[model samples]
Target: MSYYNGKRVLITGAGSGIGALMARELASRGAEVIVTARRIEAARKVSREIRKQGGRAIPMLLDVSDLDSIPAFRDRLHDKAGPVDILINNAGVVFGGEFEKVGLAEHLNTLQINTMGLVAMSHAFMDDLLQATRGHLVNICSASAFVALPYGSTYAASKWAVLGFSESLRLEMKERGVDNVAVTTVCPSYIDTGMFEGVRNPLFTPMLSPQKVVRSILRATKHGEALVQEPMIVRSLDLLKGALPRPVWDEVSLRTGVASSMKSWKGKH
Candidate 1:
């Protein structure tokens, strides 16, 4: 849509997986993208690839876990390009292990990147976004946000926080007369990214492709949708999980071996 044309989009975790896919898709559609990754070299490579395709892209070194880097990132961003029109909080980490077996440091790091990072980045750019009025903030959440699996307790907790934060922010923005600034949250099933590579889905549910997920996000942003859910089947399952009794659902989860797969996946990797 014309709304996306020439939009300045800022995305985190843009080195690979869904983050990189979204960057390429947005650039191809006429958006100037600013991509940040923990690894500076990976960011540069992605930037180069995008440029070679005749798209506008700039790479920056960013580690969401490192709070000290935010101010510098903000300054460099403002110096290079003006305020970003769209912010995609897509950087995240997953530590797979039995809840009791997982170390406190790993759990804390997961929360730091997935939850705290989103909050800090949004606050750092809130003023600019509000001034623009016509802006969008997209948070990439997971199906874990709705239901917590055995090994994903930490990941699920972080995403649940994100889901709540995004919705509440949307409401606050509305009261400020910044109706044009849309906040959309996306929840998808396991992706084929290396982070979750060896994880098996006992149900044989086809893992959603990052590209398709990106397209759905763009579509939602264009249409002003508040929430974007991929693979209608996944959405249905979410509803089912909520409607069923907790014990029953827990049994289904245990019997399906969903938790075991995620926990065992760590060793396989």
Candidate 2:
């Protein structure tokens, strides 16, 4: 039987992009997918598509940034969706530009959606995960979590925070002997999603297609992997950055175009 068969999966930001793709794929694998997005129509559209493909999916409205609404949302899920075995925190937003040049609200919104939202969803659904026979928490972090991203400062900052929070939670779960639950953090280079429409590809790191990233995420999730960072170049990022002296690493980042990769970002999608 497929590992995903009979699983109950909930994916945030399933209106489009990789989130929607993952939802459809998982449903096709025999999981009952709860597709969520801030826009009700968007979520329903994905759910409709999944059902048309003979997959099981239901649409729900969610805005992770609005913490106050989470409890109520959880209550609604308890009543209808029951326990979610896999929770994929895929909802995120990015605003890229010079730090001070971008409005403070834009920067704050990025953190609210990308960081706070993930934290809030995890906290709300963790218990449901624990009660399940085998549970998984998939957080859609970013490669920026392992390195600096100039001109896209807050986006990097938000992902860096996710990396820290997710690792901490994973360790905490282990410390508490909660072996039934698995926490996986995904860190991928710039995806071809419109959210990063104009980001320059860093040397040796070509832009990734949404399909490629989604496939990797699902493959890793099935095995309860702790981390899923892609592109051959990204796998060694932390090691290279940590092994090299500060000055040398900075120089490497500059030479590799990492330092200025986002200088041309013209996206808010």
Candidate 3:
């Protein structure tokens, strides 16, 4: 039997891209997936596709950035799907440009969706997760969390916050002796999800496929791994960042094109 055979999984931003892919993947593994997006039609489309493929899925509307909507959404999900065993915080937004070129509201919205939304969803479902015999919290962060990203400052900052929050929450759960609930933070380099549409991939750090990332996330969740950094090169750079001086790391980032990857970014966000 599939490891996810009886699991109840909830994924935000399931309308498209990574979130949608994760929902489909988990459902194929026998999970009962709650596919949610800010747009109900989009979520329904994904859920319908899963059902067509003989997987179980339910569509729901969820705007993670709207704090007031969270409780009602959570309640509805509980009433329909029972307690969630896996919560995937995958909803996020990114606007890439020079700090001055990006509007203030856009930057703030990036934080709202990427950071605050993740926090709100986690807070709302944490109790249910704790009650589950086996629960997992998966946060889709980015490699930018490990370093400064020029031209993508606000987006990077939001991911950095997510990484910190995930790590801290993991440690807190451990300290509190809550071993049943595990936290997994996925930090991958650029994904080919059109979200980073015109961004250049750094040398040796090619854009990752959503399938690869989803597989890694499931593997991490099963093994109770604390972190998942993909493409090997990302892990190397993260290690180098901690050991090198700020100026040295900055030079490396620039030389490797990491600092300027977003120069031509015309993403969908």
TM for every model, in the order presented, reads 0.93, 0.98, 0.98
Regions more than 4 Å wrong, model 3: none
The digit string of per-residue lDDT tens for model 2 on 159-255 reads 9999999999999999999999999999999898788888888899999999999999999999889999989888899999889999999999999
Model with the higher lDDT, candidate 1 or 3:
3
Name model 2 segments beyond 4 Å from true.
none
State which candidate, 1 or 3, has the greater TM-score: 3
Ranking by lDDT: 2, 3, 1
Candidate 3 C-alpha lDDT tens digits along 1-269: 98899999999999999899999999999999999999999999999999999999999999999987998889998898798999999998899998998999999999999999999999999998999999999999999998788999999999999999999999999999998999999999998899999998887888889889889989998888999998898788767988999999889889999989999899974
lDDT of 3: 0.93
Colliding pairs, model 3: none
Candidate 1 deviant stretches above 4 angstroms: 202-204, 267-269
- C-alpha RMSD in Å of predicted model 3 compared with the true structure: 0.9
Please write out the lDDT profile of model 1 over residues 118-138, one tens digit for every residue: 999988877777777478889
**Which model is ahead, 1 or 2, in terms of TM-score?**
2
Q: Least lDDT summed over 10 consecutive residues: which range in candidate 2? A: 260-269
